[model samples]
Target: MSTGFDREQGEFARGARAAVVYPDLGGSSRDADARLEETAGLALAIGIQVEDRLAFRLRQPKPGTLIGSGQVETLAEAVRDQELQLVVFDASLSAVQQRNLEGALGCKVIDRTGLILEIFGERARTAEGRLQVELAHLDYQAGRLVRSWTHLERQRGGFGFLGGPGETQIEADRRLIRDRMARLRKDLEQVSRTRSLHRERRQRAPWPVIALVGYTNAGKSTLFNRLTGSDVMAENLLFATLDPTLRQIALPGIDKAILSDTVGFVSELPTQLVAAFKATLEEVITADLLIHVRDVSHPDSEAQRDDVEAVLADIGVAETTPRIEAWNKIDLLDEERRAALSAETAQRDGVMAVSAATGQGIEALRTMMAQRLTAGHRRFVVRLDPSDGAGAAWLHQHGEVLDHWVEDDAAFYEIRMAAQDHDRFLARQDR
Candidate 1:
């Protein structure tokens, strides 16, 4: 299948003819500005050069264009003047509103969710990632399928029986999309099951799994690459690494552990997206440790952190789960200010300040991560009689054994593992 950009036949080459519009529907103007920044970030990520931007303080949204007929007319002139091929709204649009906006602007109109979905579609590389993106795209389009593909009906081909009845085109298309969605869901389920199997296998390995998560463009990918010494496309753009990537890293004083970098979270993420990306985020939910990487240099860093934590909770990653807050981009601050912030961070539990780009405070951060990750584990050496070798094997399966040496009396095993592993080991000994 062709990528979304390819399907456009190089329409995005001169750069996605684009504009950003937002409704100043109350709240702080600073918030509205931050949202525009986010939309700009999205434009940058999708290779779209934002030609123009329109924002207004609206008393209430119009049902047709979402802003108002007058505003739509003004935006239409801007779209024409800018020769925009796409109008990206900073807010979610209803099906009718999206179609009406396109008709008014004489260009493709996409909501924030749709734009982000397109970005994900183009960036998805792995098979599982592609399938998940397709699933999310289909689910998103399923609701507004009529508005998006209505123009396709005018195309003529020898496509006969596949076309079905002209009058039932909408319903027929809906059924086709629904059927495809069902199949994609099943495939994703298989993908999820396979991932779970891998996780189970990893559980028996000698290392713990650490997941890195945060808001988009918060530098999680950069930090992941910095720690793992592997190139995984650490860009300054949003959603640069859509697929979750993992690498092995040895900590300062602890054994090796698998460090996974998952996709970033965003404020007011569409529910359809959350549902579709569950398979991808399962890596975070099941991780033994979570490293919440925050861009402390961002103006809305605190709000972004809240948004990420909220999404993590919504995704069923228990708040009680152990997490380390990595306040990144400290080098972006002035020396005095950075020092002040670092002192403040020292007062916070399980929090550290670092810079992924400059490699400042990275060693200390890694040591903190390693210590917190293995906080409860204790080392033990156990001997198993010949008759209990099977039970000893079970112990090894459940714990990380640092070494194994055999003696004539018994098989000696040295392990460093969680307290639960020790309990299970003791139970096996009794049996």
Candidate 2:
């Protein structure tokens, strides 16, 4: 028996033999083979045993199955021959189409959105992460309740003899889901408020914020660990890190910076998740500098870069936000290819070639970051009264005091700081 839920495990059981069906709609820029490989990687990430894979040219989508009847038969035969327990579609499937496919193939069926949700549900660990995942899951499920409980549609007569309207089980279930979603939204608002306050506090501090973003399994966590010297779960799997992590690290010529490792982006990230995790992604939006880490060795590196940028745009990241690209995993390339890439990176203004695993080019990357952070700073000379010890100390603590001296009852000082910091200091003095 194929079981979607495992009672003993307290979670969905993976390891079921599965088959992947990639529907190649025309005009897509992504290479079909690379998309297939990525879908397989997602399957492997969840411990699913992929037994067969096939790609079909989808000239037009079938409303019932999203594929032609002949292709559906072919997939059914493949499932039977491979003895697959699950069938995964690389494209989105409507709830009715999913149900029809499961019935036709005699196995469990899920779409790209469902698979991503399952992976996120399994990987989220923190309270906030879990909450976001649950909210997204509920939102996705609310639309599928009709297919989930088909038997509940058979309505009975009204409770009273007056023949009043009767509520079907599906309607009641949907109402319950809607109510729960409202409560979850309320809770999430509180969480967002708390996070906003924390971000405000960090803004008041002296350190700059640098966020790391990239496609899934793009070695972001690896680069983050190399930079921050913290042991986060840097594994070679898709969506390995779901919760956002922040650590303080010192940059060359800079006292400290807050480096954030965020959840990696994938092509076609679920809309439900995008809405639910807005609070978590606020860090990326508010970052002073963004480090876009790319796995340069991947065959579809360019496509992955585009996908990451698309997600960033969806999250409302301004086009003017300062960003630097780190071409990581140089160690994975051949010497010849590595040298070629090195040359290419040199030609780019804000790009660096680095291998986080080998500590190669990390120093150069750090220097670049420090330079960008301090690029627009200005130097100012101000006179202060010697008795005003607090103002003098504040300037020393907040900005780089280039030189200081006291002449009679007056104190002469020079300081270098970012333009914004200087304005903030002046505002503070006025108060």
Candidate 3:
């Protein structure tokens, strides 16, 4: 099967044998074994049958082919022996390196970026999601056009009706890609503007937004469903949820909140995707609270946490934003481990251990969310004419009304709310 289009079908079409290679460049922070395992999981998520997995310690990377000549020959032999249909590299590959490897291996080859793009292309459900994926795909392809099409080098003369010789096929194709990327960017900008307006409306309503973010398959979707009582696509596979999902829920002391389940983050996530999905991730940026879920049972949980934080920092999430760590999947751990983790969480300031599957520690989590939302909020006591039902209802909806009583034909309310909301209320009262 060809690499480009057929690779997109890897997740659904079965029986495609593949080999995975992870080049362990020195001085990397991530564990090579964990990286290899994650890469294998990524391949399996797309339905590729992994026949061989190899990790090479590379002292220096070859220019033409990423791997050395001996490694290439050995891999070639194994590919022929195993009759592998594809080879997937765990690192980004230059177009020339990709072409050279494909020539040597005599089979399809794809790198981490390409594999991720394929998964995104398949998983994106909404129109905006598809547009973003297509835009990223086009941008990635634009850089490799010359390497992809050999016939692009052939000269083409203009018709007699036209003035001069026409642009070469490669130039024409690149121009077309550029134009398409421009249009897609324009469309995405419009979508972003609409999302901003919605965010503004939410701000006026002033229900706190809580966004869930974590590594792929860390049970973010499961936790989201448990918290919101909604069935999102939560599975063991990587990237099961692509499009951001939002639902309204009631929190302790808080009347309502908008809970958002966002696309999972992965290590070395394609730059193209990061740029393309900025509009979608704005939900995370504007959230009053961020719930960072972690698979505590996983061996590389700490490393995964670092990766997620790096991505968040890269996306410009302010360091001052309030965030909580949800140590999910505690059920998978042994009793002693669970007890230790629970104790550790208790000692921590903003961490909670919970199993989304069994409703463990969920109440504590909710309480913590409520506390974080109301932290540093201002308390106000206001007296209103009993006949002014609108003002009473506004206070009830916009703030946490701690107590209310009727006295002297007036409604007296004791409320606690964010300073911003308090200001907004005062502004509205003035008008």
Compare the candidates by lDDT and give the number of the best one: 3
lDDT of 2 by residue, 1-431 (tens): 23343222212235778888899987767877888889989988877888888999998999999999999999999988887778889999998898788778887787888788778866888878877877787788777854432122223211100011232333338887788779889988999999999999988776789999999898999999999989999999999999999999988657778999999999999999998899999999999899999999999899889989999999999988889999999999999999999899889888999998999999999999988887777898877778888988778756678899988878988888788888887787688
Clashes of each: 0, 0, 1
Off by over 4 Å in 1: 1-14, 28-30, 147-172, 378-417, 427-431
Best by TM-score: 3
Q: Scored by CA lDDT, what does every candidate get?
A: 0.78, 0.82, 0.83
Per-residue accuracy of model 3 over 143-249 as CA lDDT, tens digit each: 77533321223222111101112323233378877887899899999999999999999887777899999999999999999999999999999999999999999
lDDT of 1 by residue, 369-393 (tens): 8788768889988888767767766
* RMSD list, candidates in order: 6.1, 7.1, 6.8
Q: Which pairs of residues clash in candidate 2, taking residues 3 or more apart in a chain or in different chains?
A: none
Q: By TM-score, how accurate is candidate 3? A: 0.91
The estimated TM-scores of all candidates read 0.84, 0.89, 0.91
Predicted candidate 1, C-alpha RMSD: 6.1
Q: Give the distance in Å from residue 327's predicted Cα in candidate 2 to where it truly belongs.
A: 0.7
